[model samples]
Target: MIEILNPAELARAREAGALVAGILQTLRSRSAVGTNLLDIDRWTKDMITEAGAQSCYVDYAPSFGRGPFGHHVCTSVNDAVLHGRPHDYALADGDLLSLDLAVSLGGIVADSAVSFVVGGSEPPESLALISATERALSAGIAAAGPGARTGDVSAAIGAVLGGAGYPVNTQFGGHGVGSTMHQDPHVSNTGRPGRGYPLRPGLLLALEPWVMADTADLVTDADGWTLRSATGCRTAHSEHTIAITDDGAEILTAPERARV
Candidate 1:
């Protein structure tokens, strides 16, 4: 379903967006070598509860997933990319970790993700992958605005990732986020511009650009949720929830300080 928030609802969305951003930043700050993935999930739960917010993922049971996702956050490491279920694993130095989170506060939702290297070992390839996804996300956001088609954002995102020599995967990409975690107007990472749904003011979209180092294929891990690169190479993902405004797009999930 596609949703458009009124001014009052948009205000609530900003609050939810800030809460999601702050928690992710805090988790990123606390993440390091030897940090247990379960511990990170626990931290996320605490933060969500303290803020009187609801996790869009903890009990999420979508058709693609095996069952209800019983975790507060997604912790993808190394080859893992999307729907990464938290497990009994400790981060290692040089490991590339990606965290995706969505939460609802005051009846509105915001979703975002960030990928980074653990410890002090920033591998060149890992850094490049992260940079590519981030740049693609920025480009996608820049292309979003009133009257813009979803494909425009997808094309902008694709230009960056494809130009960086990374293959694009359309099976799973960005989507609409609002009263619920996921919604209509599926936003692919790459598509023909001027196609698909036309964007409008008050519409909320979570544009995510993710890429694997060497392959466009994906393999599901034994956990039943984690999506890994078929070639087992490293990967990176970047995302942000933005609202289509009168003039252009407004990033709702930016860091709290960055929002002001």
Candidate 2:
């Protein structure tokens, strides 16, 4: 459902966004070579509980997924991209890790994701993949504002990923977030401008741009949740929850502190 949040709801949304961002930042800082994926999930649960917030994913049961997510956060590594279910695996140096999180605070929800390389080893390809998604996310946010079309945002995001020589995947993209984790007004990664739903003030959208290195195709893991690249190539994903305002789009999930 499409929801235009009221002023009071928006205030709560900001709080939810801040909590999600802080938790993700903390997780990213703690994840490194030799860290187990399950540990990341545990840490997320602790942080959410400490903040008195709820996880949007823990009970998330959608048609595409096997069953209830049963996890506090999504940990995607290397070839894995979206809906990455935490498993019994340890991260290695140079492994590209992506953490996607959604939380509810005061009954409002905010979602965000970040992809980064683990440890000191920065593989050029991995860095490039992450950079492309980050740039695309920025472009999409820049194109969002009052009266803007979802297509405009999608087009802006597509330009960056395409310019970076990455194929865009439309099977899964961004969506509206409000009282729940996912909502209406599906935001594709690539589309024609001046089309789709028009932006309105107080509207919250999670604009995510993800891409695989060589193919747009995806293969589901045996676990039935993790989506990986068809060719086993590296991948990256970047996302942010934005609020459309009279002035412009405001990034709700921006990191409070600069990455060290």
Candidate 3:
């Protein structure tokens, strides 16, 4: 279902969004070479609880996934891209990591993701892959506004990735988010413009642009979670939750000090 938040509800969403953004920023700060994935999950759990908010992922049992996610956040490294279930692995210096998270506070939910290299190490190929996704994300956000069709956002995102020679994956993409985590108006990474639902004010959307360096195919890991590149090529993902307003779009899921 697609949901539109009233002004008061939108205010609550800002609170939820801030928490989601702050936690992600903190996790990114704490994650480094030799950081354990499981430890990162534990820390996420603590932060969510400390903020008196609910995890939109933990206990989340979506059809695409195995059972209950049972993790506070998604920690995808290297070839892994989406739905990354935290495991026992320790991060390496050059590992490309994606941390995706969602949370509910005061009856609203916000979702976001970030991709970065561990230990500040960047290989040329990895750098290009990561850069492509970030650029695509920016394009998608720029296309979001009232009267804009969902496909417009998708097309904007696709142009960035396609122009960079990366194959787009449609199995999973962005979505409408509200009191619950996922909702309607699926936002694929690639699609024809002017097609699909027209956006409107009060609607909250989580637009994510993720790409695998080489292949469009994906393989599920044995963990019954964590979707990885079928070709084992590295990947990157970037996302933000935004609210539609009369003027334009407002990005809610950004770090506390991140410039709006």
- Model 1: ten consecutive residues of lowest lDDT: 251-260
Whole-model Cα lDDT per candidate? 0.93, 0.94, 0.91
Q: Which runs of model 1 end up more than 4 angstroms from their true locations? A: 257-260
Candidate 3 — worst ten consecutive residues by lDDT sum? 251-260
RMSDs, each prediction?
1.4, 1.7, 1.7
- Residue by residue across 1-260, what tens digits does model 1's lDDT show? 99988999999998888888899899999999999999999999999999998999988998889879999999999999999999999999999999999999999999999999999997999999999999999999999999899999999999999999999999999999889989988999999899999999999999999999999999998878999999999999999999999999999989863221
What is the Å distance of residue 75 in model 3 from its true position? 0.4
Q: Write the per-residue lDDT of candidate 3 for residues 1-260, one digit (tens) a residue.
A: 99988999999988888889899988999999999999999999999999888998878998878989999999999999999999999999999999999999998999999999999677988888889988898898889999999999999999999999999989899999999999998999999999999999999999999999889999999889999999999999999999988877899996762311
In model 1, state the lDDT of residue 237: 96
Global local distance difference test of model 1: 0.93
Off by over 4 Å in 3: 256-260
* Alpha-carbon TM-score of each model against the true structure: 0.98, 0.98, 0.97
lDDT of 2: 0.94
Could you give the candidate ranking by lDDT, starting with the highest?
Answer: 2, 1, 3
The whole-model C-alpha lDDT of candidate 3 against the native structure comes to 0.91
